[model samples]
Target: MTYTAMKTLSVDYRLERWTGTAWVTFKMSSNNATNTNLLNATSDWTVMPGYYYRVTSIHTAYDGSTTETSKHVSGTVLF
Candidate 1:
C-alpha cells in the first residue's frame, strides 16, 4: 500500500459586513503552507453598532497534479 501528500495548502479569509443593500468585504487575510498540511489564522476588526458581520473562508489543497477547493461562511452576527 502507498500513501500520498499534498504539495501545498492555502486559505483565504474575508471579513464581510452587510450594508443596506449588499455584503461588502472590509478586510482580508491569508495563510499557506508548502511543506505541511496545517494552517491557522486569526483576525480582529471593529464593527459598527447596527450592522451584521461574518467571515468567509476559501480553502485549497493541491498535489503535484491535481487541486481541490472548498468554501465556508460563518454565521452572521449583529454588533
Candidate 2:
C-alpha cells in the first residue's frame, strides 16, 4: 500500500553547437518559447548555419514510493 505520490517538474532548455569534435552545452530557456527565434530569444549562444545543434530536454520524476524515473531526449543533430 502507498500513501500518496508526489510529482515535481523542473524544465530547462539548452542549445548546443557542434565543434567538429564534440557537442558543447549552453544554457537556453525562454519565457515565451517559439520556433521563429528559439536561440536568439532564449539562449546566449549564437546560431550558425550548417552547424549541427542539439536541443535536449531532461525529465525527472519521483513519487512517494521512493521510485524515481528519468528520461532524456535521444538522437544526434545533423546540420
Candidate 3:
C-alpha cells in the first residue's frame, strides 16, 4: 500500500499471481519515490477467479536499507 521513509526511499510495487508452477509478477510499477497507490477497478487490471495473488512493496531507503512487505488475496470461481 504505502512505504514510509525517514527521508526519501525508492519504492516498487508489484502484483503477483501463483500459477501452480511459479509465482509470476504480472504488473509492476516504475521506480517511485515515497508512496504507492492501490490498484482498483479502474486500474485496468483484470481479476481472474480461482487464483491466488499478492500485492508486494519493496522499499529502499536513502541509507541503503531495504525492506519488503506483501498483502495477499485469495479468490475462487463458482462453476
What tens digits encode model 1's per-residue C-alpha lDDT throughout 5-66? Answer: 46888889998999989999988999887756666677777767888989999998888788
- Kindly give the stretch of ten consecutive residues in candidate 2 with the minimal lDDT sum: 32-41
Q: For each candidate, give its TM-score against the true structure.
A: 0.85, 0.49, 0.50
lDDT (Cα atoms) of all candidates against the true structure: 0.82, 0.50, 0.53
The better-scoring model by lDDT among 1 and 2 is 1
lDDT of 3 at 35: 38
Task: Estimate, for each residue in 1-79, the C-alpha lDDT of model 3 and write its tens digit.
Answer: 3343333445566677778898788787645454333322213467677787766665544524645444434352321
lDDT of predicted model 2: 0.50
Off by over 4 Å in 2: 1-5, 30-46, 65-67
**For all candidates, what are the clash counts?**
0, 0, 0
In candidate 2, list every pair of residues with a backbone clash.
none
Q: Candidates 1 and 3: which is better by TM-score?
A: 1
Residue 53, candidate 3: C-alpha displacement in angstroms: 0.2
Return the clash pairs for model 1, or none: none
Q: State in Å the error of residue 46, model 1.
A: 2.4
lDDT of 1 at 32: 80
**Candidate 2 accuracy as TM-score:** 0.49
lDDT of 2 by residue, 21-78 (tens): 9878754663322222121223456676787888765433335344344445546566
Model 1, residue 9: C-alpha shift (Å): 0.8
